[model samples]
Target: MITIIKNKTLKTLALCCALGVNFALSGCGAGDSVQAQSNPSTLATKDLSAFVNTFWYVPQAYTLAYSYSSSTNPKTTAVSDQTIWHFTSANGGYLLGCSFTSTNNGASWTSATIVGSVTANNTVSLGFFGGLVTVGSGILTSSSGQPAFLMQMSSGIASTGLTHWAYMLPITSSDPSWSSLPATNNVSVPTATASGC
Candidate 1:
């Protein structure tokens, strides 16, 4: 579920969502952060070997929700949309293909796309239990070449089991804040729905 809110509210929601997922999976506190390391060569053999060519995505039912409303009326309306993600390996990295299906409570549907590439070396360390993290650039296929970004992570904990999460958002070509969006929106503890190239 995706909601449209004022800019401020949206930012708050994104942060809350990210922190919520982080804490739920690994007990990360408000101050805890996902540390990124670009040199994959320096990682341990186990860490490097953990990543495999697989397909995973956010289950439609678990998508983030969004709502809209009038400030004076105190009433809000929400629309739910489902996003499906596909990942493939390329050039020692990963290629991400995403499809956004807008549905009217499962009545109607509209699909959109965002394509991205995750370089092998552009990674984040989430500890041995958390697994590998991949970050890279993306583009909204429907837009006028609007640049975007993506982050993918695999995590496992005895309490919550295993899960895979991916996040993508639009960014200005020169946006210095691009790196922060993935970390901030890395919410949702959805397990990989399927596995394949």
Candidate 2:
């Protein structure tokens, strides 16, 4: 009788251990499932404008070869010039503008008209882990007959606010000087003469 009681007790303890192991394995699987569901790639689609608004433009100098026509003809002329960039606030609801200056043949045009308060819409798509910025459709017109549609791919870190952007413009008839300005490190406010519109 004593031997039978001991055997029953040992069997009951073994059964409880097996049950505990099963519960532990199932709990681990559930935790993995939760992690997979929380992946950033599965997040809802975000508006491009929302991403653009989060960054204010940091001024930099660029050397650009610009032309006015869509044709890559041998006759197309390229100019080296500079421009200043101004970006919108954190809602992508405003027009970010560039003030460009050009010197050609001893003649200088200062503050040449860039896009006038043109608002960018859903033009950006964020990448997984915020490693890239994909620009959708950007439409801006120059004072001359040059109309620009820009699509850019940029890479940067969100924590440092550093990014590199590349853009392509369809050919038109105006060849503008492309240059980069010295660091102004100043925020630009719209002047009254250009403000009433």
Candidate 3:
């Protein structure tokens, strides 16, 4: 379920809604951070707003939330302690509906209609997991092995190569985070004013 807040503005706001979720972890405080195991792009700094134009077709669910800023401020300077994410898939597995939007920068996001039921896995690349002022995941992780969230991007812990259909780990009732899964939109991409790609 996508939990929407009431502080919608522009780029950052929408990103927050899509990528905001304070896992309320115990061992890892808010200050704790994680890095992408491998980055595909040459960019030293990953600009998330770049995804505004470049959307991942069917993401298992966007994990690894982090904050990012470029050229001063992308659009506004509303720092978010939590990061919300947007994941998508063609097959109607988890989020069978179309992608969502937040006119007020995530004050509230509206869900779109579902178009299909053929699920597929998305690409798991470093480009998919880079750039962020901060970082966290819904998946309870350990120092070893890829975060469970990475599975959404590909097959197993070592998923690579081209993109394909794959299922996401089910968020059980025991988990302690506001998590949501797969959804996508190729044509209705949003334009972001933020410049941190």
Candidate 3 lDDT by residue in tens digits, 1-197: 23233333566344443443432222222333322233345343322222222222213243222223343444223321112233333222232223333223334443433222212232222213322111111222222342233322211122211122222232322433323222322112232211122
Q: How many clashing pairs per prediction, in order?
A: 6, 13, 34
lDDT of 1 by residue, 1-197 (tens): 23222233556546645655323322233433333223436433222222223323333334444443334243433334333343322333334343323224333333332233333334332212113222223322222353222333322233322233334333332544322212223222121112211
**lDDT (0-100) at residue 156 of candidate 2?**
30
- Pick out the ten consecutive residues of candidate 2 with the lowest summed lDDT: 28-37
Ranking by lDDT: 1, 2, 3
Clashing residue pairs, candidate 1?
1-63, 1-64, 1-65, 2-66, 3-66, 3-67
Q: How far out, in Å, is residue 59 in model 3?
A: 16
Superior by lDDT: candidate 1 or candidate 2: 1
User: TM-scores, in order shown?
Assistant: 0.30, 0.26, 0.21
lDDT of 1 at 183: 21
Better of 1 and 3 by TM-score: 1
| Tens digit per residue, CA lDDT, model 2, 1-197 | 01111123556545434555323222322112111123345324322353232212212333343433334454334544322333233332333333323324213423422232234332333221112332223444332353232433222343322123323222211322122222322212222112311
